[model samples]
Target: MLGAIYLSQEINPHNVMVNQETKVEQEGQHFFLRSKKDFDLYPTEIRIQLGGCEYFILLNGRIDDREHLFQKLSLDANKSVSDTYLIGMLYQKFDLEFVNFLDGDFAFSIWDKQKNRLILAKDPIGIKNLFYSVDSGSVIWSSAIRNILHIVPNQKVNSAYIKSFLLDHPIANESTAYENIYRLESGEFLVCENGHIKKDYYYQFKIPSITYRKEEDYFQHFNQLFERSVHNRLRTPDNRVSIPLSGGVDSSSIIAMAENINKKDNWKYNIATYSIVFDEKEADERKYIKSMLEKYNLKSTVVYGDEDWNFKIDFNVLKELDEPYPLFNRALASKTLSAAKRDNISVVLTGHGGDHILHADLNYLGELLKKGKIINYIKDLKQWKNKYPLHQILKQNTLDPIFRKTRLEYPSWLKKERFADMDLSTILTKRFEELKWDSKTITAYFNTIIRQTGHEWFDQYLSNPIGVERRYPFLDVKLMEFLAAVPPTLKIRPANNKYIIRESLKAYLPIEIYGRTTKGNHSFLITKGFKEEWNRITEYYDFKILTELGFVNGEEIKEYCERWYMGYRYDLYNASGIMRALALEIWLSDKQDII
Candidate 1:
């Protein structure tokens, strides 16, 4: 991806602006650029000089194959294109709002000489990352944090908010692990000129409550949007596709739809389904997986994930992730990505993000209470008792919402005495502090959908090296917009969650697949991976990174590690904190010459 900078007068004239690739600018320091070496012919860097003024633009992703925006810019259809045409259109189009008019996964920057401004933007969903640090009067931006680290070599790790990272997963704000370094929020366009910076949000996604009396209308509209989302992702080289299947409703739904589309289409690559399996029946989900395979006559690849656990940090993995992340599913993702690469697959369609958007939440019952629809609430409560008892119904549907305890906290492990003694946040950004308990209806669930994801950073971050683009239909803009407008009752009806999906897709999906209520369990599989790799993980575990920051309880953690593998010690060895600690070891110890 693209990494760039607009140099200011405050820079050490002969110093920070000079690099292996940087040339001494005769006048005020100009643009500096770098691109990852592996993203095919995508623009590494592009520089254009007009009227004695030099300009540069670098793009780190593919333009959409569906939209011919480049054609309007007088360019060829491409997997990768330099930002020349886009930069030209900025001045020609004369509108700073041109970004939202296009679609693709990219993080790009434009250095305009005449205007003397550096503009940086990320794609709509935040799939691509752009981070910046404005110091010494210069605004430095890049696709990766490591590149910006070049300017501030001794950037202190922001241990103050490590609690936020461990709990919410993504920081969900401008802050990064390093001091003064901030990530560009998704769809934000930043313009920095003459020591001043201004930001504009290019997209807004909000949940609005709307309902239709005709149920078929909702189903038909959803199907059209769903198909288009899948179709847009298939815009790849040779239509190579792979699905990571769990036989759950979401993945199975994608498979069912894709199989139907494939059967009726012209010459297209046959889709492959990859299933992570185990020798133990509790862990293996082949029985649930088999119904779809038998129905569709599809090709399948089964691999044991936990059998050979790869918990030790690989050098390549260390190099890929910019920060320490506790994505425990890295082993499964990396292994599957390697397989996709071997099979020449260019895009892997996933069913992540479906749970949050598709499945309705019990929190919606709060809406019924607020609206004073007591009779409907009682009827739904009767159906709720089919699964949960009255006490749980009261606690989750009423008491919790009334008390406004809707916010998810750091797991029990993070609350241990070791962590309590250390300084945590008394002052938190609004997001970290509390939730809007009054809006705990479907809104709470929508917020939850965005917080965490099975489509983890490892899956997206490792894609460049492995040459696979993992696309989630569930996160599609059109699909989400449709879901946002759907009434919560349509999402959850009686005892069924994702009521619309189950009811709408029953004809296409296998009977067993559509009717299945409980999802497959992976708790044993995950614990097994940790148990097998405990020694090797703890042996190389250096406590210096934590000690240097004074943020970790080294003695407490060491004690927990000694006993964690023996049994379930939730607070002592919380899975979240342990995995994060292991990942942090690699991030803190790295001495790579990145800058």
Candidate 2:
């Protein structure tokens, strides 16, 4: 884990003092002390100025030293501390109030020595993680719980939170898997001064005023915005970039764009593409991935899974993750990341946010159609009706008018009811109860779904070659803002979901891939594989563990496992019930005094 620490003392401590004369004369004044782990990426440096002092600390990765840009931004060279250009610019340009100007997956702390204040911030998406604690006279922060626990005494697990974990698979935002340590939520900032801590939210996805426009105009704007996002992510040079290609539009589009950029710039760098191939026919998409790789002449690696690989779930590898995330395709991703780390790849690109924003699901399309803006409604209806049967179109349109009129008229109870069927109570902890049901909750749920899935996948990426960055071009803030502004009809049309996205990429992608109907091919394969191996997986973990923990009804779980062995989809749901139960059981085991 990467971590940074800052200490402000009345005088420079002997351990941190830089000058021998100051130590002998006892003239060490108020100074800043910074310590960082994995400092090969950042060397120790000190700068002093006429006005104040600044201490720079770096960890985890190579420092990008574009000095001209730093000067252009008016960074204080004499007393400046910055690990990344983005972080430096934020502090220099906006100081403690700079949270709104940044839009990257980063967490940083700025110690304004002159003002005797400390500023800490986290990314909008909570991608890069940071946690801190402020005591009466001291403040400490770390990238991992262990780091903080090492320095601070009397660290003990919170038993009540552990009890909650036993009941729910993961703890809520207010609680951590451990006690007394709190994670700064995504888009949050904390300022510490004189032992008082004030936390504030700095960023959130703002739904834009819908503009009714020509469909082509929206499509063009989306294409340009998406391309720019991809370009920004690819700006770092000489890094061996890997794309988690799934042969779907999201990952495939990223691969195609990277290839296009490589060709245009005459870049010699090889883009390493990785995809998982399972023994199960449905799970294996290697053939399609191979087709794309050959079509583009891109260098690729296919990680084929065997039976043994299916049973490999190392909870210890991802112990840092605060909760028990549903380990679906991420198991494969973890294996791939290990392989990539072995190959010395530092950054892996993924198409995580594409589905939530650009490639929205049919449900979002339905919401748009319900709005009944006559021209858009008719346009979408014609396109959808043509692709689907006449009766289906009529039925959908019939339902649309009701939702359109009642969309904003939803009572709190009805909004809860709308999401109840999705089993959010089971997925989200009681924190869902405190949250008001509104567009923010809806957006949070949506973003939570993406972040949970992405972070689970990213767990593997982080395990190897410590500090390997996993970049998501699709989650770019500008692209999301643009998508929020565009009319929903353009985002998801009747003929195909993400119709505009596909149309925009017509020239860049293969026709077969562009016109593909399967939204995600991984789930089917995962379910099929789980069914095939149900017996082994069930028996591997003692059924009594789940029963004794009071997380699941033991007899019911055993019966479901038996039914799953007999080949039934009804049993699959039962298996999911057991899976959730077992996950909670495992989560409880990690807590102090629970077992």
Candidate 3:
């Protein structure tokens, strides 16, 4: 929760006026920082002068390797230490290159007065957020988009961003919902100095070119990295922490690992678990959840999906997020966060990002075919066909990427003319060609780094108001790097995904989770909520703003909804499209009024 404005020497600093408390109002300076005094966060707003260079740092999250960073940088351990100072020392030693050695969930900005340079960087995995808008050689940035809006009140909506959001298509990684405002993406940094601005990635996905001697070596290394990731995130003020435990392998395995570390280190703390259970048998995981709770001897607070099935619009939430969020799981996520807050929990670990990095798909099959490894491709495809139909395997791994047919289904309700000028098909096709890695690795990398960053930031934004910080052990940079290098065969067997985890944590996890094949589906909750609220939801079916803007056909949307309400079950993509449309319509009308 930090916001600031930095002006290059060419711009007038005196023209700026920020409506924030705890202001840094220094005379004859070109920058001012104002941080929200919530969450009792550490290392608040450090300003220091070293070697004729004045520096200002604003950090939203904690640094895990503070002691190591201090010792390596030759800073006195006994001296008063703060995360901000440690970062400043890193900058002193390595300049902007200091980002490589950092580890934690953080989004920070550093200002160098002597060089008139400003740098903004987010953590490698994007657990935190930093959004900025540049105009006339000046920059405005904040941890929250609403805060940035507060300063630039008359910002225009980005129609391109809206189109991509509604259509569920890929857009520029830096694009935000606002025209000028842009998000500094995960693993990236932006620098502005001397009336010039440049953005570049400090980190990129790389696979190590080494071979392991044995299969057990891979499992052992994965467990070590996984344990270190869990250990680092357990740094809280009190020894109390909580987890959003689903009965799936990811969450269950985290609970198992945490317990292992707890007993091994003899560091006992109160661990709370919160879960969203469903009445629908297909979506229910209470049986497995109970096993995890009983086995780990941990208690879980439950939030039932059937009990909290209202999809009402909250203007406050919309205002806070300042984006079009998926409507399907919002209520469930909010309820779980509320339950955690009610129990006085501030940090909640989650199993998000596991599927992207851990589960392997058939993308490598297409790669093998193209590389002339026909025998290997046939063998793998035959194995996969045992679990799925041949047509599906071929379409997903080969035909889809080549023909660009697996992108978002263009619902018949939308205006086709609006999309004609965008050349979305070419963009989608080019997306695959731009990355030269194996198909499996490329898909995993994009999902984990590019796509998931937005989701991670949204989760962070959603939990901010409730005073909860969500940490993801699966999203750790080191762990992801190691997993990236792992061969696709190790991750995806004939009948199993996440083969590495299933093999590595067999002893630690319960039999139910380790050997489980099916994962919980949220489509049940989506359908249930929509059915119960059809009448209320259809009130906005008019879509006056959207229809008037030539994005959708009102009558067509109504027909689609009526069909669903009358007993037709649309596929997951089509059903989710309706929810996405509703969310966008609300934001289009409400956000304009709010801002």
Query: For this target, which candidate reaches the highest lDDT against the unseen true structure?
Result: 3
Model 3 regions lying over 4 Å from their true place: 6-28, 38-45, 49-53, 66-68, 75-80, 169-172, 313-316, 374-409, 423-449, 452-457, 591-595
TM-score of each: 0.83, 0.76, 0.88
- What would the per-residue lDDT of candidate 2 be over residues 286-337, giving only the tens digit for each residue? 6667667877877667676644333246544333444444453445656566
Per-residue alpha-carbon lDDT of candidate 3 for residues 1-595, written as tens digits (9 for 90 to 100): 5545544455554455554433343333357776664522444655777776778778888787777887888877777767777788888889988998898888888877667678898887677778898776558888777777766666788888787766653333688888888988877999887767899989765665546979899999999999989888877777677888889999988888888888987867667888888887878999899989888888888888765553644534543456666544556777777887888877788887787677556666666767788898888887888888899878777555444543434678889888766655433322232333474435445444545434554554567767777888988878887887777788878766799998999898878888888988766555556577787677677888889889898887777667666656665457656667876776676655533
Candidate 1: C-alpha RMSD to true structure equals 4.8
Off by over 4 Å in 1: 9-27, 39-55, 62-91, 263-265, 268-270, 310-320, 407-448, 451-456, 459-461, 493-495, 540-564, 567-573, 589-595
Clashing pairs in 3: none
The TM-score measured for candidate 2 stands at 0.76
lDDT of each: 0.64, 0.54, 0.73
Tell me the alpha-carbon RMSD of every candidate.
Answer: 4.8, 6.7, 3.7
For candidate 1, the TM-score is 0.83
Task: Estimate the overall C-alpha local distance difference test score of candidate 1.
Answer: 0.64
Worst 10 residues of 2 by lDDT: 406-415
Clashes per candidate, residues 3 or more apart or on different chains: 0, 0, 0
Q: Is candidate 1 or 2 superior in lDDT?
A: 1
Q: How much is 482 displaced in model 3, in angstroms?
A: 2.4
Full ranking by lDDT: 3, 1, 2
